[model samples]
Target: MNDVRLYSKTDFSKCQLTQHPLYSYIQTFLNHDISCLVENCRNATCYAIEFGKELILVVDAQFQAGQTYPTSLRAQYLDYAQEELALTEIKGQKLLSGAFRLLKTIVPQKIDEAVYVGNYLVSTNLFPNFTLEEVQAIELLLNKHFPNKTIVYRSQNSFLNQELMEHLDVLDYQPFISRQVFIAHQAQVIKRKKSFKKDCKLAKDTMFDIRIDFDVENYTERIIELYSQLYISKYSKINPLYTTVFIEAMTDAQNTQFIGIFDDEKLIGVTMSWSFDGVLTVPILGYDLSYPKEAGIYRLLTYFTLLRVNDEQIFHMSSGVGPFKLSRGAEYFPEYIYYKRVPSAKGYTCSFWLLQKLNKILIRISKKKVF
Candidate 1:
């Protein structure tokens, strides 16, 4: 077998995707089913590199040069918002969510505003760290495929070091922020703090049941209702289309698992998790907002989710809920988003500079205390 192959519906079914890393398997799946979500793209594909049955790197490629810029930006933003944002309150969250929807509707996604070329949605940073040779191979392929267009990458700090940046035209470090992750072996079971412990205890006394399989016939409507309601009120950025596709993907993926938390036979909360490469990731989670906060449904969900995780597997709790995840012994790591444009693309460079300034200003605003 070739060391590197870009699969664009080239008999991928024969290959064992499960043998690859988690992120790679997801990318391969998306490529195989790209028509379901995106359409009429030039070279949308998934790139994979393997050495003697072991996967080295996986890249999700979307060559949208001929496509309109706004559509690509909107799709990218939807993917980002779906993965990153979450909220515990309703009022403020709703306002922010509406504003983002309006912004996406009104603002034109122009070519000049494009920061990535054939973007890697989930960088190798999150999976098994790529070796130096493999990283060089990725750089070469990216350069060949997107010589004029700027290629952007978002990765955890460990992979965004000086050596990698030296090969790129420009590297932009996003505002310093940490994403929380749970390392099972590094984590020791601990009692929740006083208030949280009280809440968990209260929730335990109630008749709450946890179910681990996804039955579309029995759970689809309720799951959609809860997800839609929570996405609007709990996330600042909302993507209706992506949410639909995501729900479909979660239900269809063989390695995926669903955790349904029920209250007296009624579904009150749901979590979508994926198990791969000795790791478990909690990607989608939400509870019915109608439940009073005092009901402690969220606490109950977290408690049981952690209990099901084995000590040998890494639990990717995912981003958001910083204070809560930290309390549960999650280690913190900074994620870096890198941007680069060739010297000829002056328009993009100027746009990126302005964007960097805007990002800094927003960071300052976020740091200020609300009265």
Candidate 2:
């Protein structure tokens, strides 16, 4: 049996995610202004459960409008679906595409109530170790406080043991893959792909300076510029808000690593990576698309990202770009977005029907069968 102690507010600050330099750096880097690492959420309360002194689970009991709801609840999945299908380019049908993007922005404006476990992007493993009893304990605690609301527990790139499989009604989607470039075996890893090999050489031939742990102000406009390109490339509605949040995170030097790629004193690319415990996460990365593709700006940035990871440390490349990631020797794993809710009143069901209609319309517009 595991000895569990519940922690909340300031008490949870001593946990590994915050104590370890890497995790602390990235969380602060990402949530600086949009949210705080150790305070009440914009529309909720933040809490955690610990076993002895090590933190086991962290969650937010959200009850109103907020970033996590509008972004994570749906827009993220839509962005991935669109990217995978390569339908980001808005061409001849300007009015239709414009309306679609507008709907994407409006749909997530309200989330009623929910509990989100793991981090915002759900990139890290929330349960390092698991048991049915422990899961039940946490559920009961949440149920006691917000019995009527929905619970969304996201576990990215982690195993779902038999106990959890049996206990929760899991909603499985497209698998989310986390990429890593382990520096300890860089030589072997690099040889896996001919293109990667070529790209690395191209990167070596190019002249670009990569600086780490810098000021957000120096590259604020550049970051926004590159990110906007990425936003159009991905047809992302979540980009505007995330772009703002990311700028705020880049300012915290203690918890953020801001890598700026410059050519002759002009910024060309930026990769923002955060670390916690021994794990590193590259949540935001952007480069000027106008630059020579052969210059391999992306390849150079990726090469340096791998250099930061060693055998003992893990790197989370977040999600998407399946074949490219696999070619580079990054392992793939399933990430689930679990939803549990008690039977709701008639009005809630009506809202569900309306959401279904919106979902179907989106599917039609994207020409992708999500169901």
Candidate 3:
């Protein structure tokens, strides 16, 4: 049986991370090891649960005047969010019994070499309880739907959930797709109640005048030109999601805000934020590199973002690799992910028959990849 209960925001500290099933890096963002991972689409709130004890704390981000709390109480800091964003209520029991679960709501910001970005983006996350045969059955089913996507059988996110992974024998399988998925989230704001104030950094003898555009259509191509520079500068290899049409489509979505900083005629940096409900999350930010002496492009944009959106909405700085945003009062909010899958009917009928064939092939392929 799974322990799923809800408590007030004050209970997050009582959470013990050592027992949860995830990686060590998450400790900075979550109050307990037993956390929940939700997409950045809604007023995402985090529920801290002690899977072993069934103890749970339902904490949400609230923006109240003069609200403050210790950093350790993860939810209290959520009060600093920019607006009144509502998140999905944790359906305690329903979550515990899902038929299938997958990891990676989105891709993390930082990119490293040789890591499979596809796996991070597309791997089907499952809990740690099924047998090896059961896992293969699931994969075979998915292959039928997404023949082009790669699937990796990876470990439980942390120890609290490790047993399920161990029991299922999922971590042993290799990835069919080559890329690792990356996930990220950040704060987005409605127009604030307060004034929009920004400390603009202008070069003393500039050829262009600096202007800000709320209309994305005005500076989209320019924004991409600037962003592509930062991306190419950082990563030796590039992902083609940066094409002009793609950038324009994402920037112009109804629930998104694509903020731009222009140097008279040239675009310097752009902040592309996605929205749902009232929460707007900055999923991507890019700047022009030729203006290295003016490294202030992104910094100026962020300040403008906070000051402009502070009074109305809360910003969602992600759990991974965002020191700049984190430093500007974005606090830690723990998230958890759960996976459970019941084999499809077609396979269940002939489990004994297919297991025999799939298991033999799996072992052989695994050895080939290893050697």
Candidate 4:
């Protein structure tokens, strides 16, 4: 028989997660709180849900207006209008901005209440084998517990979680393409791609040394700094702002490896890879941007991490840098966010429906553009 067990912050000790593979990583959030990992989601509350043998993390948040992108429904769906509009190279930029401003006005309605299943605010949420019965059970439990909140499942793609997504779709959940992600199968990436071979050669011939074994304790601050330089400073600030505490806990977690790139004695690049089932994802990676582009610090880091993917493991390279990942034989797929509003959320029906329409339009627009 399939059953669902939910564990809140106060009752976390009652759950038996010691035998779970991700116990340590999950405990890190429970111990120091999730705000240390994702600063924008400080108001979010997390819970652990056990369905059969699978353990899933749930993040519930009441998103406020003007909240940053990561945890904000308005920012992701409505604010993204600016970027989506830019892709078409339309002539009237100010008009598009004005339209977006008008749309943002309805963002703070009842749509703010959301419950994200299997959301760690990471690049991908690796799912275990969830039967259809399990999905239905979990959905029922979430609907009962979260009442008027929108239940969401993020970071889903056809390549990795096709069956799971199909189950949700059949259950009447609306699918929205959140972003495009790259996944490299070990067989295809290692055997077929000539560019991958070249990347491997470049990685080996690079002046920087790749060190798999390092004292993470000594370099916790450095890791945060390097990661911030790329993810926060260069990329959008909406990305998770990981602190030293998160880094320290991740280093000590099981099935997780942190690789460091050294230029002589100075550590210049860092990448951390974690695996579950047969999937491996490098959620944390960064390098010193001061180095010339020719240095290939990022390339070296990617190559070394790709090497960790064994014969059966598929590497979830996550989103962005489509051309680079494509050259290395990574297949692109649209990652989706599947959501369903509870019956009590009828007041926000129009707002939710508008977001869904916008998401569909964005997906259609993105299909024409490469990446």
Candidate 5:
């Protein structure tokens, strides 16, 4: 078995990641502290670990400083609990609200001691193939290094990481459904969905011009502003608040592709996506919400995104906009965060056990609504 080696920002160059596929992305992560680029990641520290051919990014989050769900475990579980509470309130489920309120009080302190393996701090963290031996080796390494922390692997779903999830399950990791994500295969969606066909037609008929070959560097600030308008303003501020520096790094990166939707040569919408192992994931997508809805800017962007990827590849649209994604023939799958309780950290273990139970109930009740 190959040895597991860890690299910090100070010595990341020694890992010789220049030849790696995600070199540019990893370099950006190290050069600029991830927290500065991502607002919710203030309390967490990132490290890279090399295990054979795989380069895994790890996050050590001991404090509950972030107000968002992605970086803070407390926030992650609470967000769902709160959503469930709201649903129960709407349905007059007063009996369940008390239990959820208790969860709100207990979850914050208990779930804070965690170290996430394979965390990219993005919407999705892509993984390379891992043999059972590799999984065991990495588990052992994490257990030794982070003895008092709950070991976690975030951004996993059966659609993409079935084998990895199975391996973790075999190793006694508890799987908690974090959220439901939508995935679409372009050829299939195009063939089966009438709504998708209409969207494509609308995109073609729309006045906005979609440009694949443009100076992405020149539009960094605009991209950030547009992205913030949707993701931060319209949506919850809990989402990663990406900056111009992050946009610049993405444009400079070899692996990512950018598409701009221009209204009379002015960028109104943008998407930054990357493909790995024949699967495409768009981490950044935003448009001018101020634009009239009749314009169908969002619809146009989605259609162009489908056109951007190969017909054979699957597009992981990520979570949210369930109705919109479903209209385009996207299939929903429960995304999970798998974790192993450290025996020494009994407090976190008990809290995680309780969280697991809560998640099971929440998953059952909100399954349809979440998608």
Candidate 6:
């Protein structure tokens, strides 16, 4: 390929066997996918062949400006085995490496260092009997590409790390970070479900019936209204990825499920959750700040929705900040992130390494406090 050009999400949506992901999480949390994130810089217009063997989506950020797609690719890989999939396996589901691999493959511009992005972990069919060697292949490929870049993943427990570094694994898999948190899936071993009743009585007194609805489109404006109250505050900033249009896209009846807190006639709060074959994801949630003194809506929303869900055993709760989610009866979880850098090549290696270590330490220290 000459150089990867940009392909609009619409264009890619037309590919055969292409299933557009519920972009809520990415849209809500990330600025945009690879292309938009690098719009000002030169990048690739990659075509994914399907979440294939050991890989899901392969995003070629284009190729080197003058280099050819060499007959033999000196590349490195990272996938599910040590990422989100790694966490899944810890929870007892069979896993194969297929999530995203940008961390392993993104190399510096000079020195023939080119990076590729991939994540194939999310599969409709469960992959069975996964071994540690699959991750070895990913690491070897990534190291080959950068030569100097170090591969680091916070989700790795020691046993898995040793397996990744046999003598054949020549590249240095540096310890750039430690003790990262994997955000807990809400459905992992559900305990007895409970919701405080006093909150409901308060709603009843206010003359609004508290009803939860799966049909989110019925109240898109209200959903946005509550979301804005939660997000448009001193601690919040606007995310271009989650425009009103994107929110509407998520509400497309065919795509997402919503749970709303309503008065007999007025909408008061909303929580939006999504489902894959087995995993339920909560991407957006908020309550009206009008009830400032009481945590009623926050606690009430969780209870109603948690109890109503048919399968609560495999849910992924997006955990962040603290105090509120920590106390609302949802359990705490650690979310993991990894990075690759070459000190000599790009030279962000050591600087970033130190930064990650202190950040991890701070996070662990903060976790001690709960409401």
Candidate 2 residue lDDT tens string, 1-371? 55655556555555555653334333442334334432223554545555533454344544433233222454444344443335434443455445446545554433435665444443344234445566576667666766776666665333323345545533321222212121123335645667667766766777787677656676776787786676545445433334544466557534457788888888888887756555666656888989877777777777777666566555565555545656666655544445565455334554444445545554454333211
Number of the top candidate by TM-score?
4
Candidate 5, 1-371: lDDT as tens digits: 77888777899988865777776677778788876778666777778889776687788876655455666777767654465355333454565667767877776475667888877777777888888888888888777777778888888988889999999989988888887788887666454678778887787688888898479989888998898898777666667788787887788775688889999979998899877767878888889888998898888778877765456678888987787888887788888888887776556656777877878776776564743
Q: Rank candidates by lDDT, best first.
A: 4, 5, 2, 1, 6, 3
How would you encode candidate 1's per-residue C-alpha lDDT over 243-309 as one tens digit per residue? Answer: 3444665576556778888887889998776665565665556789998987777777676666655
List ranges where model 4 is wrong by over 4 Å: 65-70, 80-99, 188-191
Candidate 6 is scored at a TM of: 0.54
Q: What is candidate 2's TM-score against the reference?
A: 0.66
Model 4 scores a TM of: 0.93
Give candidate 1 misplaced runs (Cα > 4 Å): 11-18, 21-125, 155-186, 189-196, 214-217, 237-249, 252-254, 308-311, 359-371
Candidate 6, residue 130: how far the Cα is off, in Å: 8.0
Model 4 pairs in collision: none
Minimal lDDT window, size 10, model 6: 120-129
Report the CA-based lDDT of candidate 6 relative to the real structure: 0.40
Estimate, for each residue in 1-371, the C-alpha lDDT of model 6 and write its tens digit.
11122223445443343243523322321233442332222333332322222212333333344222210011111221233233322322232232224333443333223333332111111111123454455555555543653443333322223343332234443332222222223432223322234443554565444554455556666766677677444223221113344456566523356777665656777776656444455556778788764646676666555543344334444434444444434554433323444556554554344445544543544355321
User: Worst 10-residue stretch by lDDT in candidate 5?
Assistant: 83-92
Evaluated at residue 275, the lDDT of candidate 6 is 60
Q: What's the CA RMSD for each of the models?
A: 6.6, 6.7, 19.9, 2.2, 2.3, 12.0
lDDT for each candidate structure: 0.49, 0.52, 0.35, 0.78, 0.77, 0.40
Better of 3 and 4 by lDDT: 4
